[model samples]
Each structure stands twice: as structure tokens, then as C-alpha cells.
Target chain A: MKDTALLSAPLQVQDLTVSYGGDPVLTGADLTVPEGEMTAIIGPNGAGKSTLLKSALGLVKPLSGTITAWDQPLAAQRDRIAYVPQRASVDWDFPTTVLEVALMGLYRQLGLLRRTRPHHRDKALACLDRVGMSDLADRQIGQLSGGQQQRVFLARALAQEAELYLLDEPFAGVDAATEAAIITVLHGLRDAGKTVLCVHHDLSTVPRYFDHVCLLNRHTVAQGPTATTFTDANLMRTYDGRLPTAA
Target chain B: MSEFIALSLPPMLIGTLAAMACALPGNFLLLRRQSLIGDAISHTVLPGIVVAFLLTGSLAALPMMLGAAAAALLAVVLIELIRRFGRVEPGAAMGVVFTTMFAAGVLLLEQTDTASVHLDVEHALYGNLESLIWLDGFVPGALTDPQALATLPPELTRMALTLAVIALALWIFWRPLALATFDNGFAQSLGLPVTTLSLGLVVCAAMAAVAAFDAVGSIIVIAMFICPPASARLMTNDLKHQIAWSLAFAALSATLGYVLAGYGPLWLGAEASVSAAGMIATVSGLILGGTALAGPHRKA
Candidate 1:
């Protein structure tokens, strides 16, 4: 058949449904994120893009169906996945420094009751160095600008060292140089055979940035190679009922 | 004035130290939005103490404190389960779990028939530092003389030891606590066990609550748990600075409150019934509120 067995998908979400209290944000959404590639999920506001990523990370519980990663269930294999939330979702004013936040990725490995050893601290600094945030390691998170905050989170995800990386809107409020830096980091991860799935908002950069794409509006409109799948028709369906081809 | 000083100064010192210990953990709890869990555990520990008392019929601090910590830890696990599996909101889950546990504790007290043991809900809520002063001293061994010399207040010693243990715990887990409180998801991916850290925090908090129960009483411990850290948060966005400032404020408030409660009655033309514990709480609240209102929007 197509060696589907050997080429196992890193993340497989089947008929996933989620809601806030009662209103359904995603109904029967299905997606598969492959290993060793950069996949971008793009849509307009309220398109359930973030919801899709949240479900995958177990941040939001699915009402039905299941999600699997690397042939194992996502529930039992939490350490194997890393999530980078939207820049605005957290309180920057929280009394923590950049290095401290970056070290959070080491929490799972170090255990809650354990201290971050000199080695772990050194590793966190290394991730920061990769993201060019090593100089700002001791800066209070609240004092950082939006772009710096975004970079800090990326470094945190890097510190996680997970096989599967899920990031949401990392580029929304960042500068172009930071965006380029983030893209470079993601490209490096992809080249190293790690899977990266990012919920992105920039339509113009999709062609240049991502290797794969998932177009979604409640249900997944399309999923495949960016060149073959991000067609005018799919973009129109993702945006709304209005067709870009007819226009 | 000297008599009042002798009666209250020692307890006030112990209470201030206890409050400082509580504030260290409280800073993280407040940021994580788990401040009310302290109030919950403080109340729920009553039944545990009562049970331990009924079993021994002797007032021993160690066993009773262990029993209280165990009970509070159970309450925390239950809250986590309900929040995770039941898909309940955090606030609602906390309210339900704490209230349920508190009610169970009350029922346990009635069943144990130790209502008149004087560790009732009121005393548990509104502590009497006066009582702790008498808890000071060493019991002579059987081989020693029948008439023994008295020692310094054991309450002070216990407070000192408790604070040392708490300080050590914070020092070890400082980074993880900071990370988990700010971003749990990232912490988890990094392989940090946010749950274990949370459990450790609650256990430490429970231990502190039990340690201070004698000096600060259970009720006013909330002031210690929340006030200093809340006030410190207003002044700085740095975690280290918050810990330092909160400790300083806690020590200052305790001294000020102790001095005021002892001497303010002469100026007011009436005997002051307000305890140093209450005065410190009021002062901490005022500082917290003032700072929150006037503090810069830069941090937020």
C-alpha cells in the first residue's frame, strides 16, 4: 500500500470535538501531523485553529475520539510533546525571570521536588543562546517587550527538546527579525527530524515559511503539501463562503 | 507596659516568624491562583487534630501536625482529580472540595465527641497567641529530678525549626515553582512534574499552617498566607524581590501590630481586645490595597 505502516504519522487526531461549556468550537475535526516536517495551520479568527492545537497538547479535552503520537496515546506520553501557547495567553507580570521561565521545560525531567542542577541551568542558557536570548536571561519577564517574550517562549520550547512541537501564534506580535529567527529555529528542528506544528496567522509568509499546511475552519478544509493544497479555493473556504477564484 | 511586653512580645515574635514562613509559599500560591487553598486546609486540619487527640488523649505537636498535613494533602489530591476528570472550573472545584472537606471535618469532630476539648472551630479560626506562650519548655526525663527547671518557650523553638525547613524547601525548588506558577504547559514539556511540585507546595503549606497553629492561630494565618506576598507583588515583578520584600513587610507588620495592640488602648481610653494577629492582618491588607491601586500599570 504506501508503506503507511513505516511512515507512521507523529500525531493523529480523529473526529475530535471540543466546546467551551456548551458551545462547540470544533466539531468532528480530524488532522494528522507527520514526523520530521514543518506543518502550519492557518485560518481567520475563531477558525478553531488554536482549539485544534490545544486538543493535541491535552490542554483542552476532546469530547470524543482520540489523539495519538508516535504510535502511543497522547494522554500517557505527555513528556514527548511540547506546547508553545499564544504570546498573550499568559500574564507577563508574573514574578518570574526569563531564565526561570525557560527552565520550566526542564521541570518535567527534573521533577517538581527537585532543584534545577547546574547542568540543567546550563542547558536552559544554551537554548536561550540559540534563540539569541542568552543576554536577557536574568531580565524579568514583565519587563520584556512583546517580541522578546515571544523569543523567550520559543527558547522554552527548544529547552523542552520534545519530539513533537506545537506552537500557537508565535509570530503575531513579533518583529520581522524575530520572525526570521523563529523560522530558522523551526527549520532547524525539521531538518533534525523533529515534527513541528504551528498555528500561524500570516497568510503571505505561508508560501515561504512552511513545508506543509492544514487549512481549517471548524472542520479541516485541507491538509497536504503547501504547494499542492493551499490553493485559492481552499483559502476562500477557510476564510468564508466567499470564493477567491470567482472574485 | 513591661507586663504587656512580656505577655505578647514573645508570641508576636514567633507569630511574625511563622507569618514569614507562610508568606514564602504564599507568593507562589497567589500567582497560581491557589490562595484560598490555604484557608481551606487551615480549616480542614481541625478534624485531623481532633482525631489525633482522641487517639492519644495527649496534646503532642508532631503527630497532630503530621495528621493535619496528611489530611490537607488528601484535600489537594481530591481537588486536582475533580478539576482534571470532572472538567470543573478551578474556582468551583476549590470551593466544592474545601467546603466538603471542612464539613467532613466538622462531622468527624462531632463523632469523636471532643467538642469541649477547646480546639473548636472558632479558636481554630481566631488563634490565641497567649496560649502558645505556655507551650514553651522541656519535660524532664524520668531519671531527672521531680522538680525541674523551666526552659525558653518551645513555641519559639518550633517556629524557628519550621521556618528553617520551609526555607530549605523553597531554596531547592525555587526554579521549578517559578516556572510551574507562570507556565505549567511549558514546565510539563520540559519534563517538570507540575503536579508533584504543587503537592510539595501544599504539603509545605500544611506543615507551616500546623507549625504556626499554636502561635498565630488558624484564622489569622490567612493574613500570613496572603497579605505580605500580595503587597510585595505590587512593588516588584521579580520573584526574588517579592520573597525579600514580603519577608521584610511580614517582620515589620508583626512588630508594629504587637506594639500597637499593647499600647494603643491608653490613647483610646479603652482596653484593646484586638490581638496583634488581627492588627498585623489589617495593616498588611491596607498596604496591599494601597500598592495595588497606586502601583504602575507597567507590570500588568
Candidate 2:
């Protein structure tokens, strides 16, 4: 908890709650994402991790409280944040290519009536290259494997060039090699002074990959460095210790 | 044989042109899952035409048509506003806006003897193809050859031009439109004017529906707008491919439906004229049904 006070907060969510059709999914949740680190939100199923991230990005409406990004309201300053929704949320059968989906990250910048400039296209390709997905740029989205689709979404988020990134379950169902590739890219981004918040599973890999961890279950169970807050006690509280607590 | 030619050519040409026009905007709407919005606006345009007629004292093509276009555009804007501010479901918002506008139009038509004035709401629904010949013509002095110079009716011509404009607009803004349709939040984060883009798409769809009203009637125009693109979607997952295939199917359906309307009943030895619009829809439906049935269900 001492490390949490030392880290500079980039996103501050205060008393945020979300509901779908009047059934509350997240209740009175509060957490701060520190600047220039990879923070993994780990919790059991239905822990409201996804809802918290969505609320922080202003994607989901909060019943009460507010989210401030870089000391400003999220709505007034949208360009600073970019969100990568779960791969499952999209209709993969949608009529678009990998490069096109990546290019869509620039839609907020280039706009509706305007065309994607040569520079934008070049940047999109560069982001794809960062994810090692340049070869599949022309392929349609439905033609992609699960890991490949996740990488494409990562490329899209990277293309945003925003100060903060929010990714929902980017590692679900991906292979080891793809995970390594993604982590490598994410680590580089983190080192470059960008904040990356991922709603991650696989608690075993948290100590190796993330510098900070938020153990949440409807509310913040613990928040600190991976070594400090990711102890057996926190694991029990977060996931009820289904696996070995020391993983 | 000549009688067949005489009765069939007008409906064929009109239906083909209208169906083709509707397909252009319908492709995008179907992709966006808002195809039913087209049906709502089409029915809503009747009162607009009636009002336009009341002010002008005749169904003077320009004013009446412009009124219909404006009303349809209003319906789209209202639907958008409700979705944004009311936080209502998009489908429900469309239903509310269109139904209200259409009901208003119906009331106005009934109050005003609009039918005798040639701006009838009934004719707007089941368009009389036989009368289209009397109403149809071309730009008088614009043609080099007297025969090829024949133009469609002023209303249909305007509708065709409006469709061309919408098609051109879609071409110019295809990438943003595609991106927005897929993920609106991403588009907004990138600094795109998402509201404007969405509104523009709805307006374009409304324009297409207005143009389509004179040929196929409002009820069936929905099929023209939804079927080809939906069928095309089943065949491919590329936007360009979908649009191209939809256009091809739309043209093919128009030709087949036109020919069927002319000869299907005669071939069956019945004294009846096949509904060209209905047949066009049926053909497109068959194409979609066949695609759905035969498509590979497992991951390719």
C-alpha cells in the first residue's frame, strides 16, 4: 500500500458504479492507475473489472461519482485515452481488413469526411509491424486466428498514440508466443512513459509481467506492487485461492 | 407482343432505376443494422408531400418532393436526437420517430383532399405504374437523338440524381463510415466528428428512401434497401466486395423481376400482371436464403 502512495496517479476513478437494465454490476468501485506502468486488474469472474475499466474510459455511465483523466474530466478530454474492447464484443464477420481495422484507430483523428493521409497509413503499418502483424494487414478480420485478432486490436490501440490505454482481456485464449509478443510491445510502451491498464486473467504471470496490480471483486480488494499486494491473503480475497496461492 | 412491350417497359425502367438507387444507400444501412429505418421514413413522407401540395395548390413536383425530402431528413434527425438524449434503443427511437411522423402525414392527407390533387397517400404506397407513362418524359431539348432523349418523370429523375449524389458521398466518405459502423467509440477517440458522420449516414439513407417512394412504394422499398446488401454480406466480409456484389445483385434482380413481371403471368396463361417490385424482392430474398443455407457454418 506504501508503493501505491508513491506512484503518480494518471487516472482517478471515484465511487463509480454501473448497472445494466437496473441490475448493478459494479458497486462503489474506486482505483487509480499510475503513470508509466503496466497495471493488471485481476479478479474472479463477475468481479466488475471490465465495468471499472469501461467506466474509467467513460464508455459505461456511472450511477454516481466521477472519473478524472490527467486531472480533467474524461468527456472533455477524450483524445488522451484509447480503449480496446474485448475481441468477442466485435462482429469478426464485419467487412473489414486487418489494416482497415487498425486504421480505424485514426478515425478519431482523421475524421469521417476526411481521408486517412499517407502519414496515418504509414503509422498504422508501423504499429502493425510493432505487433509483427504486417504480413496479415490485407487479410480480412474474420480470416484471423484468435491471437492474431487480439494483436490487430492492439495495433489499433497503439495507432491511437494516446497517453493512456485501456484493454479488456487482451490475453484471453492467446498462445504463449503471441502473449510474449504482446508483452514485449506493452513493456516498450510502458517504458516510454505511457499508462497501460489491462483487465488480465492468469494470475500466475502477474508477477512477471506487471509492475502494479489491482485485486478487485466488485470493489478494490488490494492495490500495490505485484510483490506486495499479490500475496496469498490478497489472492484468497480476490480469487478464493482456487489454485495455489503462491502462483 | 407490342402490348406487352407497351405496358412493361415503363414499370421495368422505373422499378429498375428506383431499386438500383435504393441499393446504394441500403448497402451501408444494412451493414449498420438500421435497415428498418428506411421503411419508417418512407411512410412518414406522405404527410410531407401532402403539406407541400397544400402550400403549392398542386403536386408541383419540386416543392412536394422537396417537402418529402425535408420531412424524411427531419425524421432522421429526430431519431438521432432521441437516441443521444433520450438514451433509448436505436430501434425503438426509429420506431417512435417514424410512426409519429407517418401518423401525422396520414392525418394531414385525410384532412386535405390530397388524392384528387394527384398527391394521394394511397398512390404513394402502391404506385400506379400505368399512370407513370403519362407522367414520364425527358429533358425536351437536351437530347441529340429524339428517341434516346426520353427522360424519366421529373420526380423519378430527381430521385435518380439524389441517389447518385448519395452514392458519390458514400464513396468519398466510405472509410470513416465503415469505421464508425464497426466501432463508434474508436472513431470518436480518433477525433472524428462521430455525431456528424452518423447523422450524415441517416440523412443519406433518408434521401434514398425518398427517391425510392415513387417507384416501388414505401412498403416494398424496404426490401430493395435491405435484401441485396444482406445477401451480399452472406457472400463476403469485405466492404467493397459487399457493395459491389450488392449492386450487381440489385441490377440482376431488377432485370429478372422486370422480365418476370412482364412474362411470368403470360407464361402461366393467367390474365394478370406480376408485381415487378414484389418479384424483385422475392428474387433477392431467394438469393439471401440460398446463401444462408449453403454458407459454411464452421470456421474457415
Residue by residue across B43-130, what tens digits does model 1's lDDT show? 7677677677777775468778867866776767888899999999877887887778767766765566555545555555556665
Name the top TM-score candidate: 2
The stretch of ten residues in a row with the least summed lDDT in candidate 2 chain B is: B134-143
Q: Candidate 2 docking: what grade?
A: acceptable
lDDT of 2 by residue, B1-300 (tens): 434333455566667667767787788778677787667667778778777878888655577568887787787799899999999998898888878887787778777775564455665665554455522233233334445445535554665687688888988888777777787665554556667887888777767666666556675577778887877887777788888878887877877876776579999998886666667778878877877777442235
For residue A40, model 1's alpha carbon misses the true position, in angstroms, by 1.1
Clashing pairs in 2: A108-B190, A108-B191, A108-B192, A109-B190, A109-B191, B47-B105, B138-B151
Docking class of 1: acceptable
Candidate 2 chain A least-lDDT 10 residues: A1-10
Q: How does each model score on lDDT?
A: 0.78, 0.76
What does DockQ give for each predicted structure?
A: 0.41, 0.40
Query: Which residue pairs clash in candidate 1?
Result: A105-B190, A107-B191, A107-B192, A108-B191, A108-B192, A109-B191, B125-B219, B136-B154
Candidate 2 CA-lDDT value:
0.76
